[model samples]
Target: MTLIEIMLVLGLIAMLSIGSLQGWREHQQRARLEQQAQMLRIYLSGLQAQSYQYNLSHLLWTIVGKSGCVGSGIKPADCASAGDSLFKPTAPDITVGVYSEKTMGFYGLRNMAQAGHITLTNAAGTIRVILSARGRIRLCSEGKSIAGMAVC
Candidate 1:
């Protein structure tokens, strides 16, 4: 092949590779966010089950920073400090948040008395794992559509 033709082909391949790399990176980030949301949803369901199985009213589920902690009693700080530890994301450049109607603690009951959600954020996007007082769990993109599907 001519040198000029070879160079042109190489340049085209490089451009295509760059675009593919970018798309692959974005897809990876999206998958990570989705996995994080699913993990948080599982944790919430586990907490609800623990509450029901043990029939304890003081077992409070609290999230501090990226950490989720559940402890007996009303103090979130105590929960964070002394409560059973839940999973936290170990990935860099990611943030996890928890929000609840009752910020302090939710009484452990078969039926939740309050609702809350957990959000995971990264450069690619954000996703939410919701916890309802009626003991429901859901996953969705936070305030935005992912690819085309609405946040659940």
Candidate 2:
């Protein structure tokens, strides 16, 4: 091929490579966020099961932008220092927040004591860890849906 034709072909290939790389990076970020959300869901579900198995109440207390803890007790303050440290997102850009009308992250196995949700967000998207009043724990995506997660 002529020199000009060769350069044109190389430029096109470079453009395609850059586009694919950007897409791959976005996909990776989405997967990371989804994985984190699923992990939180499983952890909360385990806590719920433990509460039922032991016939006691469990508490998951969270500090926005910080961390969370899981413990068994009547009050969050009591569980704060004694509770096991819950998982925090290793992704530095992700932010976490807790939301509820009554209280924050109280799980009683028997009845509907409280309902709350924890949200995880980053540049890629947002995922919410929902705790229903009926003691159901689920994960859903906000803004854009992630693979295997419901849209909120």
Candidate 3:
């Protein structure tokens, strides 16, 4: 074939490959995030089932920065970013966050939100479990909740 035709064919192939790869990566990320969210949900659900309080309005979950994963309970070193969003952290607050409510059936993607980088929202009104200093996690949110699930 002509050189021009060959070049055109290669270009098209490259473009298609790149696009497919990008889409695949995003899909993987979404699945990973969803898996992490589900894990946190199970944990919080267990807590609710084993809790003594009827409403669980007192239990709170601490958030640990991705940097050091301290102060929050789970050590930063243990947060596996591959399967858990809590394992991911930007910076500044190598270990920053406020306490959250996880009792009474409140759970969500742990540590999926940041200050400057906003977008952490739970619509299902479920729980928003944040990562702990020791790498553990629990449900918590800053806004008013409706006693449901933290729909992210």
Candidate 4:
């Protein structure tokens, strides 16, 4: 093959590889966000189960940012927030938001309380994991909705 032809083929291959790498990176980021959201949901459900087993009324799941250890410690003390007596230990960089009803009571399995949501966000996108008080978990994208689904 001519030198020019060889160079052209190499350039095309490089372009294709770059494109593939970009696509793969995007997919990996999306998967990470989904996994983070799912992890938060699991922690929230576990907290609820603990509340039920212990019959504690003041237990709450709080979302701690990178700066604060507050509710994410062994005991829900030394935190800045007032109602955040419970927190899930998460990575230092991730921002997970937890939502629950504002009341003092143990959340039993049969309570059927208002739905709670956990939001996981990154540079790529955001994923919201919805947890019903009745222990139903659903996944939804932020600011987008489908038929018979909730948007966060």
Candidate 5:
């Protein structure tokens, strides 16, 4: 091939590789966000199950921030007291928000008075970990569809 033709072919390959790399990065970020959301869901579900098994009322409180802890307590102060807590520190390129009810108590054989949700957001999309009043935990994507998850 001529020198000019060879340069054109190389440019095309470079462009394609750059595009593929960008797409791969986005996919990886979305996967990380989804993983964080799923982890929070599992933690909350386990807490609920624990409450039922022990037949005791358990309180859950979370702060909305890049780094925060989900702790068992009637007050935010209890989060620092420590005992059965999930502490998340600066998840990779993701922002987290807890909406509606910040403090919830799970009592055996009693239904929640209101529902709450935690939102995990990245450039790729947003996922909500919702806890229903009936004590159901579910994940739904918002604004963008995520693989293996339902759209909100």
Candidate 6:
């Protein structure tokens, strides 16, 4: 083939390769988000189960934003705004993970901050939930799943 024709074919191939790489990167990021969201779901279910089993009235009350939580009156509900006493071991910990530039939100609400003791956070492809205000866990993305989740 002519040198010009060979050069043209090589350039087209290079363009295709670049496009494929970009697409793959995006897919990987979405996959990470999905994993995070799933983690969050599992955490929430567990916390709900725990409180329900123990019949912890105060902790359960705090979940849906009612009074009677361990330190709601004495302290603000915002996780970052709380004091040491609010974070005491006796208190049910409802904390989401932290995020900054590495995080993005669904509907621009990536950080759910604190609600009772269920915390939600997202860093772009990563999201987590910290329950009983104890350990940190990941949140699953709201999307269709090949794992037989019929809804997002």
Best by TM-score: 5
lDDT of 3 by residue, 1-152 (tens): 99999999999999999999997865554444344445544544444343323433223233343332211222343444323423233322223333434321222333122211111222222234554432244444334432333533
Question: Predicted candidate 4: what Cα RMSD to the true structure?
Answer: 5.2
Candidate 2, residues 1-152, lDDT tens digits: the string is 99999999999999999999999999988888888888788877777776677766666566566343333344354324554546667676677876765564544446443677888887788898888878878888887788767888
Model 2 spans with C-alpha error above 4 angstroms: 66-84, 105-113
lDDT of 1 by residue, 43-94 (tens): 6667667776777553445445544433334455533355445556655556
1-152 per-residue lDDT for model 4 (tens digits):
99999999999999999999998877676666666666665665665566567654324444445433323223444455434444433444446554545521235545443455656666546666676656576788776442223566
The model with the greater lDDT, 2 or 6, is 2
Tens-digit per-residue lDDT, 25-120, candidate 6 = 666555544453455455345544444455432222121221122222333565445544232211222223332322211111221223322333
Rank the candidate models, highest TM-score first: 5, 2, 1, 4, 3, 6
Work out the TM-score per prediction.
0.77, 0.83, 0.44, 0.66, 0.85, 0.42
Error (Å) of candidate 4 at residue 30 is 0.8
User: RMSD, each candidate, Å?
Assistant: 3.4, 3.3, 11.2, 5.2, 2.6, 12.7
lDDT of each: 0.64, 0.71, 0.39, 0.56, 0.74, 0.38
Worst 10-residue lDDT window for candidate 4 reads: 66-75
Task: Rank by lDDT, highest first.
Answer: 5, 2, 1, 4, 3, 6
Supply the global lDDT for candidate 3.
Answer: 0.39
Candidate 3: regions farther than 4 A off: 52-58, 67-152
Worst 10 residues of 1 by lDDT: 66-75
Which is better, 2 or 4, measured by lDDT?
A: 2
Q: For residue 121, give model 3's deviation from the true position in Å.
A: 9.2
